[model samples]
Target chain A: MTEQPTEGEPIRTGIVGLGKMGISHFAIVNAHPDLELVAVADTNSFLTSAIKRYTKVEVYKDFKRMINEAKLDAVLIATPTRFHFEVARYALERGINVFVEKPFTLTLEEGRALVDLAKQKGVVNQVGFHNHFVGTFAEVRRLVNAQAIGEVYHVTGEAYGQVVTKPKTSTWRSKKSEGGGCLHDYASHVVDLMNWVVGPPVKVLGAHLNSIFSEGVDDAVHAVFEYKNGMSGQLTTNWSDTTYRKMTTRISINGKKGKIIADRQEVRVFLMPGCEVDGYGEGWSIKYITDLQKPVWFYMRGEEYSTQIDTFAHNIKSRNTEGENTFASAYATDEVLDMIQKADRARS
Target chain B: MDRILFGDNQFFGVNHMSEEKARAQSMKFKDTAAIMKVIDVAYSEGIKTFMCTTHDRIGEVTDIVRDNPDRYNNFTFYPGMPYAHKYANAVGELGIMGTLKKFAPGSIISTVIRGAMAGITQDAYELMKMLVDAEMQRFQGTRTPVVFLQNVVTDLLLGFNMREMFRAFHDYVQQKYEAEAGFFSMNMPMLVDVLHGEGIENPIVCSNINKIGFRMCGGIEKYIDTLKTKQFRPIAMSVYASGAIPPEEAIKWVCELPKLEAIVFGASSRRNIVGTRDLVEKYWRFDN
Candidate 1:
């Protein structure tokens, strides 16, 4: 087991990868009161050198050497998807807490192995499925759990963005094996949101992956899901939609007594005449993200990012193994992604 | 600062309330001239200050104002620094070294050498000064009475508990640019307290101060308390909560707040601009 820090002592932390998300996480981690960012590792010399020049933290070109030398109590992994399993496993084996970015692993087997290893080590582990911390989305889950929308019959999850409008050079995102496509980068968020608000689909009834702008990778994903209790849902995600200025994820739930439509900004609820939910009235009620959100200590991009990091820090401090966005929970999402891919391949 | 400062969100397709509206505005203002037309309208309506992000396109707008001194004689620009997406896009296209070489203010050799020294000394303030100079490059030949640190960087520094950077920015802008340094943040209460602790009296801090408390961190009550008790010049943005509140109610409520130094709003058309300006005028009087 890892040595726990004394109460009030900061958690010694190390981070691997210096991509866009990595840099954002680095900022947040460096600022967190509970985390003392000790070291950072990145393969890109320019990024590492720039970070070294700016911050007092140690920088290394090799993550393994950094992890070995930094004496870190925890590690945040934001590397490309294919590297997740190996990096996470290496940390977990050392009894170090791990926080891996979303699309937890490239394959289901890898995700399962990491989840099992994390459990065996009894470490505080989390996946960066940030939407679970969004106020509007969290409210949706609460209302659904409260059965505010009684006897849920159907749900629809959608995400669209203008990630790639023109033909671009190949980055890690354009490579399917490197987790560059919409199915992994964009659709994973929608799928995880759906899983969090509603339940994960037990069966993938039908699925199709389309490539609108990139080669060898899917830019759009359409899938139909079936729950064990006979509820059904659909997911539609397109990263090539130029109409959107940025990524927008929305989930609509229709039930016998009411309906709920939620996005990153707000959540709208409709209840029948007799249906009742606290703080919400019948017919229609709108709740904005501003009213629902709690004040984060540090907010960049969104409160959810900081919230997730804070939660992870708290879990590590309290040694709470099972928490929001755990390794097991992310592994379940990976299973659904696998099923969707298999269904799409069988049809094609 | 102007009491009713104009904002640049509408011209840049940044409607937080509605994506459809944002997309429509993006389409409508694809040309720089279209944006200039709206600015002309706001100017005609007596809103003389343009509080804008340092987007690349804004460089063109500044150029227009710089050239036609007769048209924009009394106009002022409150430029917020580090339009973060610009840097992100630059890093994506150009490697980190290339991005620094391209955007750093001084000669390339000096930039790299100073960058290394700043790293060795762990001098974040020196690096921050360089970035401030880089972002302020486009505002040359214009009347920038107040320069703002964007919410992204301000809030990040607030989280990092780096109060020295805030002071550095405040002092640097005053000494270097002859301008008062403004800060845009999501958490006004915390920022005000930090600045107050740093002995920066009556600092200029802009945040989302609206009737509905939209995007106002620390809740509406804490914000009210800060306004009532703190000694900071408050500039209210997102006054309508991205159209969630009607112009009449939003202006009425915000104008009633204690010591609200300014209100920054954005609109695309003459009608909306005139409408908001009239409402602000009805509630709050501008002596100047």
Candidate 2:
């Protein structure tokens, strides 16, 4: 795009693992004048052979060989979970910037260790929690802090979609050995969101149920967290449901100024004039604290995602310039995700 | 002193007192209930908030608050739904693509390595670090005030490092809101007591995470004991789970309620309403 990778020019980039996400990354990389998809790697021989025939740049069976031979300035890891550590570590150890996918690690220790390694090697390393870049949550967070809804006393969230039915026979997901469960794959995002909205989960209580497509791994999960500020939240995620395929990500915060519900992408505020409920029967009357008029939909999508990416890039660049490419920012909220999975596993 | 929140009166159990006692110490003694009993008490006492569950005992608070518009005005309930159980995310991801990439028959399986780099450490940690970083970013300068709920899982199913587990949650939250004084789980009230007594000194937010069903259980005195060891900003909760008690008794216990900083409890019946009023009035002892 920019004629060629030039000295002091924006770094040319390539992506590995051309699944849907990988392919998207590829096109995006190529679009950047300063960046180019110099090479692409996929283990599938047939896929690699086909890609080689279609693309101008070289294609390889392995990312490591591609990185070494192609001399890439940066690599976008679109690879699966287990392979991340190896690929990321290799790239960092070599001085190549790396962008790896989410979950970072299946275990906290592993995740922590990678962070440490990133620090030691001083390479540009980042894990994608892409949603954080979106601006809506930040606005909702702003209102909550301003006591916009009053005092966020309690919070609840529901994330629903197709439920995961563990296949009868056997898949990696069926066994609880890998990161195949719904909690890790899906709820981790919710958990991360919880950390972002409130704080860290002081405690996490979970119920992992695997019914429909059951080999072993759970399909749906429900979790509750108690915040340190005396606030609390609940998050529910499902990967298997035959019904309407909808993803409802709503956070209802009962605050003081009003009742706030952050539904899907935007935040809504309701004025709660704590009044009396009408009479139900006899002398006893119920409270009429329902249907507080409020903001319905106010979405801010692009900014948050961009901010998230920029922050990672900035951290990486700062680290690189300083010869300490380790993430200089605060600890990521993901440390507890695997624990949620582990805890969910023991919910019986 | 940590912030204290009064749970619904019945949480301490109403069945313990009598109907006669209920009549004697009811709100008719002068229902000073203003701005919702809980919010009034919280505002008056300078307390923040408290947690509540929609359990059987929860009925008591709903009953009283249901009727009175004045006394139980801004009563906020901290619903304890989907209580903390435990969980884990084991087996890291296999490589992303190529023959080395392990694909599950369904979701995620095996640690597929092509030839040499098998079982290598992954970027999972980096993901967590970034997440923690981002969380802190959210609460860096929050005005509404936030705290961390320090948690411990007795039945941990994740990789061992219990301390690391605690640290992860702590650091994660610390990145955002100012870390609260302390954390509480139903089972670990004693642990909280120890952590507090040991001088960890952050105010403790009450949670029955450790206690399981705080209603059907005992050992609440773990809280009382902790209270004794060191004065806690007891966000007192779990009073309703005391069982199908009468309003009078619930009110009376609430009247006593360890008197930390704040208490937010609901009255179950007319008697409970009256008792709540009487409890506030009598305890503050004729205070204007």
Candidate 3:
């Protein structure tokens, strides 16, 4: 599902970490006419060779060398949690725009440092919270901004899965010391979505961080928070549930005038008396995946993932740091996680 | 504790009394399919509750049950929290601060950093709650009648004199997760006293209780005293005392204990599972 190039010199890009997410990034970047996948790097020789087979891109074991030599305009850091900071730092310092994967860094300090450095370099940067590009959520943002929900009173979100349930050889994602856990690995997306859809939480009222399955790494998180605007909310996330096919997030917003319940595949809205939007009436209305999802050239993965990359590329061409997803916003999410962590540590 | 609960130690390689047996069970149940097969056997034998550790492989088993809801309708999970090895390895990899950030929620991650800079830590109570939430995530949509604080953390808190966490955990599990709280400990008598100090009466505690007193902290008499007099639910685990005692004598002794509500055991084969089931049913005097 390769799309024709959309005019002008494409943003030259390099990808690091040829894991599942890294490969996905490669295909989308390679196919998009607006961007060029110039080089890829990974410690795994097998993955790098696989990329070389089809695409004649520069391959390297050292991402630093690849970035220095490839002379790319942008880079995607898709490495493990431990490497996100160093890789992003390398790219931003070199004046290359970056699209780093989410749970942006191992810690809030790393995330903040990256954001500050990226700002200093004046590069367009974004975190890979692909849910922001999902049509349903985008629609939610639009309607919420338009006051379609009419003063959202509260919100509740749940993201549950069983991705890392069994004890295996520890990876960076499974280790707490390496910034692996449900909160960083999974809830980062959930909280980012909340901040994007609702407003940033002003105070963390309460929180529960669990390590049900993994040792030190958290497999679940439950938090209660309140927005600066007096909108209260709760976030529940888990990565050890055996029930889900993959990570699935469900959000429920209670507004002064209506209510909206949404997940990855669908959105159901209920308007209060006399609440009206341009396309919606005052009762329950539903939008399924087919209704909300945009068709893309590559139908193999979530359209939102490709859409997010496209947004990042377009933002680079326009010299806009404020895309639908931004480092500043991601930093905001990092700050929130830090707050919850400290709150958990400091709470009596 | 109404239904006999199946333990996941066999699947996850955690034999308390024997290293060799633990290793063997680990090898035998190494495959997820193998674990699934035994779980099915447990289910067929009418053991509906799986009081399980949140091991990575248990997720595979949970998925199997979740996929076939019709077949495992009565299935429930009593998920135990703070799998210690996960944290130990994590701390080794991420460092203390890094590990905290890893589990910290996104919204407050920055705040956590700021607090750390200012020399403040989120409370243990809050961490306990978050840990429970983390463990409960995988058991979602299933009947999690109770959530457990595993012996590692439970006893750690006991040693630190952080009895307040017991109350916090008890409250969080009941209020937040809408489930009862369970505690697994080697020192059942001390834990019972600690919970009592927190005003937690009739608490559910799973501990090793057998005739030989194998690994029975504070000896057998103290546990027997607590079991006989304390107004709490006792879920006897390691009734075979990690196989030091024979099955029939061990089962009879534990079943005769006062307030012994349930027994949790792990077995890889159908014969052992069926044998345990028969012994439990034949000997357990539910009336007493």
Q: What is the TM-score of each candidate against the true structure?
A: 0.86, 0.46, 0.54
Report model 1's chain A TM-score: 0.99
In candidate 1, which residue ranges exceed 4 Å CA deviation? A45-54, B27-34, B63-67, B89-141, B157-180, B187-203, B211-213, B218-232, B243-260, B268-288
Q: Cα lDDT for residue A99, model 3?
A: 91
User: Sorted by TM-score, highest first, which candidate order results?
Assistant: 1, 3, 2
The lDDT per prediction is 0.86, 0.47, 0.77
Per-prediction DockQ comes to 0.30, 0.01, 0.01
User: Between 2 and 3, whose lDDT is larger?
Assistant: 3
State residue B21's C-alpha deviation in candidate 3, in Å: 45
Worst 10 residues of 3 chain A by lDDT: A292-301
Can you write out model 1's per-residue Cα lDDT over B47-95, one digit (the tens) per residue? 8999999998999999999999998999899999888766654544343
lDDT of 3 at A33: 66
At residue B28, candidate 2 shows an lDDT of 31
Tens digit per residue, CA lDDT, model 3, B1-288: 563689888887665443345558778877999888888888888888888888777778788888888998888888888676566445434544455567655534455444332312234445556666776777778888888888867765564345777888898888987989899987788789889999998899988788876556566788899888888888988888666578999899988888888999988889999999999999988764
Q: Flag the better candidate by lDDT, 1 or 3.
A: 1
Per-residue alpha-carbon lDDT of model 1 for A1-348, expressed as tens digits? 768776899999998987767877887898788999999998765456655654678999888998788999899999888899989998898899999999899988898899999999999999999999999999999999999989899999999977666666346777888877889988999999999988799999999999887889888999999997899999999988867766889999999899999988878999999888999999999887767878676667788998999999999999999999999999889888999999999999
The top-ranked prediction according to DockQ is 1
- Encode model 3's per-residue lDDT on A186-288: one tens digit a residue: 7888898899888789988888888776787788888999888788999999887865434677778888889888876667889987878877888998765
